[model samples]
Target: MADIQIRKYRDDDAEAVKEVFTLGMSEHIPSSFMHLLKQPPTQMVFMCVFCALLASSKSILLPILAVTLLLAGARQLVSYMFNSYIDTSLKKDLNYITETYLEQKNSCFWVAESDGRVVGTVACLPSENLPECLELKRLSVRRSHRGTGLGKALSQTVADFTRDRGYAAVVLYTSVVQTDAQKLYEHMGYYKIREFVIPELAAKILNFTLIEYRLNVQGD
Candidate 1:
């Protein structure tokens, strides 16, 4: 988060927001463009040929040809998707949770930006079906930018947000693999309340175990 100016998201922030969402992960590349370029030589040549065909002068059915060639181009790039293991299966689960949480209109979303690049984000949701509790989700800082207190800043920001919204407690879940994050959560006053093999936690156990932590925001 690195002294970022935090604020609500704008429509122009789609790409930056996606970048912040993916930060601090070994499997993640800067962009899908980078992910495409890192492919093997054979795949690279295939992509080049397809792009050439896409720009050919003798093309009458260019649109159809483009779609056909693009599918082939996609096949060449499909391996990258397999190479990256999406921990937490967070993409799908995140979308689901965000949608549900937003429907209630009780969650807050914050984005951190530094030098025009988004480096971090924190999101809060009312916990489960509980009206008085909140769950912090998607708190992250870029790997190259850790130890700058963005995590704590996001936590405190979310805490204040929940308090302002009248929530009595704030809770969140983290992976056992993320020791630093667990420590940070604890340092920020979140306690390990329950441990279980829920879908998201179970997905992490395939790579590393996970624990759920809760913080009593009202107590503060």
Candidate 2:
């Protein structure tokens, strides 16, 4: 913590920032796959397929193999979903951090550096859907640097930025799989405003949900 420095995003830090984000998002693949497996639809389909295969082939090995393959495929789908999001973000705002968060009004990006290497990132911008509110996005900390109050420090950075800009509140969205993030935001005085499933065929089938949380800085 003594070596960590939180400051504005710089051009040279682009690659490091993206790496932190990609790695952070990739770390959730296992949990997301587990979440998919726990869904009722996923369980029902796997059970039906396994029973059908077992009855038809009259071979436990074959059914087990088939189920294992299905599980692997499901895990691949979860990985694909997370990878796609990473790619999209890279191609979008992340690809143009300076313009998206630095040059714009009421928008900014920050990175945490430790011994001259970027280890964490967080950004905020005016919310598209919520008036007088700023949306916190891209909050990520390197795995090796987690559990040292870095996440809370980054979150508080956003809250302080929002308050300084006269924003009423700060809103952020995190997937249901990110339990730790939810807890961190809650501990920072943020409240759950709503939850919604991603409107994609695969996401809908898997019941993938995103939760929105809001921290009121104006009143506090």
Candidate 3:
């Protein structure tokens, strides 16, 4: 770990972060799941809401509703079917840094480098709506570097950054399915604040729960 150095993301880091992001996603969720997630926002949300309406209503519009649901479901199926044929691609981890850095706010990225390569990264962005809360995201470590305390160090760096910005608290959300992430948050002094899920996907997926975790940075 001596060779591992953490530094802020520069414009040159864009492509590197994208590569890391892709690597992390490929190592995690199934390709099928990523397909549904990557669907066009308009189509995805429309189909989700369409399903919700169809489940609750049974009236003269049932035929139209049924057709829409069938089409949406078929689209989802097609998306998954063709997903394997495309060249390998992964979610861009640069999303976190691009969002924050572009805002010109107190948002930043920390890259863990070793042997002249980026092994991991953590990103933090101050909450615009909730001043006391800092939003942390995109904490990822390469597979070969796990269990070497890099994650903890990345988290603590975010905590320190939040404290330095005079924030009283830090807040983040992670899927309940990620038990390891929950454990890490708890270990970092973040307590479970609430558990809820968006009504649309709540019944479609496993567990269907999202946990909000928070930590007091100013000891408040």
Quick one: best TM-score, which candidate?
Answer: 2
Candidate 1 residues lying further than 4 Å off, grouped into runs, are 1-3, 25-104, 199-208
* Candidate 2 displacement at residue 43 in angstroms: 0.8
Instruction: Tell me the deviation in Å of residue 120 in model 3.
Output: 0.9
lDDT of 1 by residue, 4-106 (tens): 7888655565555555565554433233334344447535565666667667755646645765675555544432342343434355444444454445577
Q: In model 2, what lDDT does residue 115 have?
A: 90
* TM-score per candidate, chains pooled: 0.63, 0.98, 0.67
What TM-score should be assigned to candidate 3? 0.67
lDDT of 1: 0.65
Residue 141 lDDT, candidate 1, scale 0-100? 84
Instruction: Give the poorly placed runs of model 2, Cα more than 4 Å off.
Output: none
- Write model 2 residue lDDT over 87-189, tens digit each, in one string: 9999999999999999999999999999999999999999999989999999999989999999999999999999999999999999999999999999999
Which residues of candidate 3, in runs, are more than 4 Å off? Answer: 30-99, 199-207
Q: How many backbone clashes does candidate 1 have?
A: 0
Which pairs, if any, clash in model 1? Answer: none
Over the full model, what C-alpha lDDT does candidate 2 score relative to the true structure? 0.95
